[model samples]
Target: MLDGQSFLISRAVPGSCEQESKWIYMTQHLLESSSNKRPPSQESEEQEQGDRGKRKKSPECPDTPDITDTEHALDLSDRQGSDGDYDDANSFINPLGRDITISCLLRCSRSDYGVIASLNQSFRSLIRSGVLYKLRRQMGITEHWVYFSCNVLEWEAYDPYRGRWIAIPKMPPNECFMCSDKESLAVGTELLVFGKEVTSHIVLRYSMLTNSWSPGIVMNSPRCLFGSASLGEKAIIAGGTDAQGTILSSAELYNSETQTWETLPAMNRARKLCSGVFMDGKFYVIGGMASNTEVLTCGEEYDLNRRSWTVIPNMSAGLNGASGAPPLVAVVNNELYAADYAEKEVRKYDKENNAWITLGKLPERSVSMNGWGLAFRACGERLIVIGGPRGSMGGTIELNSWIPNEGPPEWNIIASKQSGSFVYNCAVMGC
Candidate 1:
C-alpha cells in the first residue's frame, strides 16, 4: 500500500474581531466550569480509557498495489515529532488538564485537528474518542469541508474556512472498483464511496477519526445510481437500480453513529441517476431515469415524521434536458437552488409558488458536460460550483462560490489546482 504523505496548503483567511470575542467568551465559560470540577475517580478513568481503546486501528490491506502520489504531496515520516508516550492513556495535555486542554483545543480550527493528533498518544486518543466534535455540535460550532474526487481511487478534502487541501490515502486496490461508476456521500465524520465489485455492489468508507479507508457496511439492498443525501449523522438513499438491472423504489436510512441501515418506505416512483438533497427538515429526490429511455421530471419528498413520500409534479420540469445528467441541485438555509446546465444559468426554487426563478448566469469558466462532471453544493452559507473549463486536454479545476441575496450573482474564485478531469464525485461534511 502507498503510505504517501498527506498534502497540506495554507492560505491566510481574514478574521473578524466579533468572531474572536465570541470564542474568548466560550473558552472562558468552559474554563470557569472546569475550575469547579472535582477529581475523577479511578473507575471513571478506566472506563474512559477503555472507550478510547475500542477504536481499533484498521489493519493494513494485504496485496495492495502502490499508486503515484500527487506532486507537492509531503511524506508521512517527515511530519512526525518526538513526543514521549504517556503512562496514562486517559491523560490529555497533562500540564493543562483535560478540561482546560479541551477548552483551548475547541477554539482551534478543525483543519488543525490532524496535526494536533500527532502531538502524543493522549491527543490522538482524545480525537479518536469523538468527544470534541460532539461537544462542537452541542455548542453550534461547525466547519464545512468539501470532500471530492477527480481520480477514481483518490480523494481530496478542501477546508474553505482555512483555504487548505488535505490529500486522503489511496483506496484499497480492486480492479472492479477502478473501472466502475461510483457515487459518494459524506455523513458525520465518514465519507462513503459506493461502487461495484465483480459480483456485487460495495461501499468503501473513509473516516476523519481514523484517517483511513475501509470496507463499509452495505445497505439492506445494495444499489447504485441512486439519489442520496446526508443530514448530520443520518443519511437517506432512495430510488435506483439493483445489481440485476431492475429499477427500485426501495429506500434506506443510514445512521452513521450506529453504523447501521434501516429500510425506509419506498418512494412513489422508481428512478435511476437521481439527485438527493435535504431541505426544511425533509429529504427530496429529484430528476432521474424511470426506465432505459424515459426521463422523470417529477420529484418526491420523503417525510421522516409521517413515514411517507409526496410526489411534486413538474417539480423538475424544464430543468433537466431529455438526455442530460441528473438535475444539478443544492440546498442552503432551507432554500433550494438548481444549475441549468443547458442555459448556463442559476435558478432558485420559490417554495410558495412551487416554481423556479432564474437568478443569474453561472461562473463563466465553470463548465460541465450535461452536468456530469460539475458539482453544485452548499458549503455552509455559500453556493459553490466545482468544475474546470471545457477542453479535451484537461487542465486546472476551479472552485467558485456566491452567497445568495437580493442582488445578482457575483461569483468569486476560491481555489484551483491542476487536474486531468473535473470532479467525479463530491460531498460536503459539516462538523
Candidate 2:
C-alpha cells in the first residue's frame, strides 16, 4: 500500500468531487468574511495619516459668532439698568398665560436688536450718501477755461489740453465804439474798463455771462489810466489822469446790483499809473507817477467799510506804467508782491512784519522807459511779464515770460516782434 496521504488523495479525486467543491466554497466564504472584518491596509492607513497631518497644518477659520436674541436683550437691559439690581415686586406682569402665549419675550428681544442693527446700517449709508452728494456738487462746476486780453479790448480764450487759443467773435460795430485801455480790471465775470476819452470819464462794463458791453455810470471826476479794485459786488476806481493832464487823487465806487456810482474821499496824493489791490476788504494803492514831478514811494489804504484813506509805508521803490496794475500786487504767502521800477526788481511787502524785501532782479535796466507799458500778471504761482518796451530803445520790443520764486526759474520768451514806436499800451491775451 501507498503512504496514507497519497492513498487518501487518490480515493477522493473522482468520487469526492461534490465534497471537495463544498469545502472549497466554505473556505472562500471564510476568507472573504475574514477579509471584510480585518483592519485597513498599511498604504490606506498611511494615506489617512497624511491627510490628517495636512488638515492639522492648515489655518483655522476666523471667528464669526452668531448673536442670539436673548443675549442681545440681556445686553440692552444691562446697558439701561446701571446698578444691575432688579425688584421682583416691581416687575411688569403679563396678563396672558405663559404656556398659552409661549412668551413673546424672545421675539421682542430679536425685534429690538434687529432695529438697532438696521439703524446702524442706515447711519452708515447716510454718511456715505452725504459724502457722494458733496463730491457730485463739486464736480458739477469746474473751472473749464480762462481768457486773456492785452490791447484793443479783445479777449482770447485758450483750451489748455488742445494747446491753442480760441478766437472770440468781435464785438458788434455799434457795440464796438467804446473805449479800450490797459487799466481795466477783471474780477470774476465783470470787466471794469475805465477811460477819459474826451470831456467825460466813462466806465464800460463787460459781462462775461452776457458777452456784451454796457455803459456803466460815469465817475465824479474825468480820469484815465486809473487803478481799480473789486470788493464783493462793487468796484473802486482810483488815481488816474484827468483830461487836462492832471493827476487825480479822487476815488469812486461802482455798485453792480444797483448800477450806481458812489464817490469816496480822495487819496492823499495825486497818482497816475497807480496800482490798487483789494485785500481783507480794503484797497491798497502802491507806487505810481505823481503830479508833483516825482514817482510816488507813498502807499495808501482805502477801507471799503469805513470809506476812509489811511497811509501805509511806502514801497521800496517807485513803480510806474502797467506795473501799477493789480497783477503786480500779488499776495503770495501772506505778503504783497509788486515790481519795483526804481530798483529794477520785484519787491515783497510783508503785512505781518510790515517790512519790504527785494526778491528778484528784473530782466532789463532800472530806467522808467524800460518799465513803461510792462504788464505783470499772476499766472498760477508764477508772475508773467508781458509786452513792454525795454529802456529808451524806441522801436525795440521785449517778449513775455514767467518768473517763479523757487525751483528751476527761467524766462520763457513768448513774442519777439517789434512793438512799433510808442508801444506804451500792451496787453496779454488768454493768460
Q: Estimate the TM-score of every prediction.
A: 0.80, 0.52
Which residue pairs of candidate 2 clash? 148-430, 150-427, 150-428, 370-391
Candidate 1 residues 1-431, lDDT tens each?
Answer: 00011121111122322344444455445434433332221111100101111111112111111212211222223222354433444334455555556656665566656655555445555666666766555444567788898887988877776566676788998999988879999988889999999889999999888778999999999999999998878899998888898999999999987899999999989999898999888999998888988889899999999999999988987777657878899887678999999999999999888899999999999877788888898887788899877566667888998878888789999888888457899998877
Alpha-carbon local distance difference test for all models: 0.74, 0.45
Best by lDDT: 1
Off by over 4 Å in 2: 1-153, 157-164, 171-182, 321-328, 341-344, 352-354, 362-368, 379-381, 388-431
lDDT of 2 by residue, 285-325 (tens): 87677754567777788876687898876553444543333
How many pairs of residues collide in each model? 0, 4
| Residue 258, model 2: Cα distance from true site in angstroms | 3.9
Q: Cα lDDT for residue 131, model 2?
A: 24
Candidate 2 worst ten-residue window by lDDT: 45-54
